[model samples]
Target: MRDPAQDPDESGFGFPAPLWRAVARRRPLGLDVRWRSPLRGPWLTSVLGLVLLVVLPVVTVTGLLSYSAYGPQFDQAYPGDVGFLRLPDFDWPTDPPWLYRLNQGLHVGLGLVVIPVVLAKLWSVIPKLFQWPPARSLAQVLERISLLMLVGGLLFEIVTGVLNIQYDYVFGFSFYTAHYYGAWVFMAGFLVHVPLKLATMVRSLRGTSLREVMRTGRDQTRPETGPSHGLIPTDPDPPTLSRRGALGLVGGGSLLVLVLTAGQTVGGVSRYAAVLMPRGRQPAGTFPVNKTAEAAGISREAVESWRLTLTGGAVEVSLTREQLLALPQHTATLPIACVEGWSTTQTWTGVRLRDLARLAGVTEPSSARVESIQESGLFRAATLQGNQVDHADSMLALRVNGGDLPLDHGYPARIMVPAIPGVHCTKWVGTIDFEAG
Candidate 1:
């Protein structure tokens, strides 16, 4: 069924082999069936894939867990499209106060660490990307589709994640929604690729450990000859670097990137070294502020006359900050972890959430919504599951680090829920509407 022209060049470019070679010799990238990179082979690609197996799962799991910490069941679920997958509807644990901090730190840090490996893996498989005839059969067609998804989805995720952490919004869409959906897309492709390539990866690495491959010197380095994934070039150029040098270059670059940026995740003196992290080199106060009172448009007049309104009670009760302070005050040390990956732990003094619920005549409340005084913004309101509302450490915070909350630190009143995302803590809280079952 193959046409004579299709059999000649097989690139679907319609040019015969001689003409194709003539045209390709003058181009930046050619349709030549083989590449000339001596350091690239199945051995290299498998090495990078193995590294990703260890790193990518941590990033993916923690990233999904970060979203779960927002209490998606209580109207805080972002992206709202609950597609083919939805995280379990359960109360995010509150026992470990530093839960979100550790989870997000690993997510953001490991995410950065995987970049070099991905790049190296892509480089090793460049010849396959330009494979002639595109697909020879249905299986090849399916592999090509999955490969496209794997590469494209991951590239999109990396771009969005990097720009988001830097507070750059050039993407012109909601970072939260787009990144959330994009993660699912990448994961779909990633899942398909792993099973399909697991056997090939294992075969390529059998008896050929990375250390053995890396020990090869420039003089001994030769183009791979085996038909391992069809990546071995037919006409390889002379070696520019040994296999050892290539692996070292990629490994060294990845290690360097991890060391420079991971300091922010651990915090303290190490954080000072993570100058590349925007939040790591933040304010010298108790901790950095996500949004200043000025930015949230908080007015001094409103602060002076601030009243926390408790609704869904026997009687709607409004209390001034001083009056609320008169009630039994409790203190809890909790970490406010942001989705952007920076976290700070501070001791907060405030009225217990259960007490507030009682005041609202909703003892043993099913759920509650905390509304901010900001008037408008995605973060202005957040709904909390009953467990979050009733947690012993959950409070409407009035002070931090034994001092009155600063204007930039959600002064006057803020909700501090154990193990909650920072944004969902609902800074400058003006109202708490309780729901009784």
Candidate 2:
């Protein structure tokens, strides 16, 4: 005989009865309420957190490096020169041409691996989101807010990253701005959560042997309760997945995802194995283009009439197809590494950009702005640092693989610089302003 106030049903396990009733009544995916899992404990959560602790920093750092490679540093001199960040004037090293490809590949590959780990981590702590008395104190309230930031930021970054890799943009906001700023927020939350959980993680990890805990299927620190004890009622059931089994499943799934998509950027024999790649094998002298010439609203006649213009300082020179061809032509086989995790090498033949600068009467210009004929878009124009302009391989590419440049490949002339992002290598070159300052 229990008092109504003390009854578990009436008190709702420390939560209000109406709240529990609402949660119970909400059917998620129409699954049997009894079949749903209410298993919440610290072992799996701690283990998953440990895995994320190891992997997430790598993902974040590599991603930041890849973004930096796009020459975000130039944004300082010319405000709003690049996308979101008004970054300092820093030049990405151009020595190792393969550096950009390797960093970008790692960023995308590691990002894929994080998917399973994040899912497992989120699933483990989801029960806490519904815990009774949502906030016990000011610290708990702050902790919950940080938790929200961590979860929201991570999901936003991962989802947006995947979409960018797949060239899908369903959202109205710019992916670069959102993903870039979101990373800072995510990391801030991550930094906060790490210290809070570090002591508990260390203690839980130390007190319990992983093998023994997996075998017993219980977190040593938490009291063992029957599966039927929480939110959705469950029948008396044994643990469906052991700790070791869950780890193996997550690891195997992550590995599979890596194998399926990594080859698109890694290239080599793995390219054949990359079954999930969005862009299949491209035609000779042509790689996959995210935006087609037609999609960019460029007509064949417009490209034909296009002329390369060079200005700034004491130099204003416009060169047509024949005039550009007359200049000293140099060829270099360079890889066009896109941020979207796809890269392809092609032999580009064109006049050295420095030669054009020299023709414009501006020697050793600090920076040059390259504008495209593509009417409108985010990357219609890009600024090349002095280092990029001076690079021996940097040129105004007139041809690819010994053939006339294709429309999708920035026909007529495109800025093809070594060790730079594909986007910065502006297409359909129309103007070059040599900024001496």
Minimal lDDT window, size 10, model 1 = 1-10
Question: Model 1: per-residue lDDT, tens digit, 1-437?
Answer: 22222254444433244554555455545565557787777777887888887788788889888878876666576877565466776778876878888898888877877888889988898887776555554445666787777888888888999898888999899987888888887888899888777766777788376677767789898876554566777778899898888888988988887777777667767777777888667686568778888888997777888899999888999999999889999998888888877787789999999999998899889889889999778788998888888899999999998999987888799999988788988888999999995
Clashing pairs in 1: 313-360
Segments of candidate 1 deviating more than 4 angstroms = 1-29
Q: Each candidate's TM vs. the true structure?
A: 0.89, 0.79
Cα-based lDDT for every prediction: 0.80, 0.74
Model 2, global lDDT: 0.74
RMSD of 2: 6.8
Off by more than 4 A, model 2: 1-41, 71-89, 208-236, 281-285, 313-315
- Cα deviation at 79, candidate 1, in Å, is 0.5
lDDT of 2 by residue, 230-269 (tens): 3222342455665566777888989888888877886767
Worst lDDT run of 10 residues, candidate 2, spans 224-233
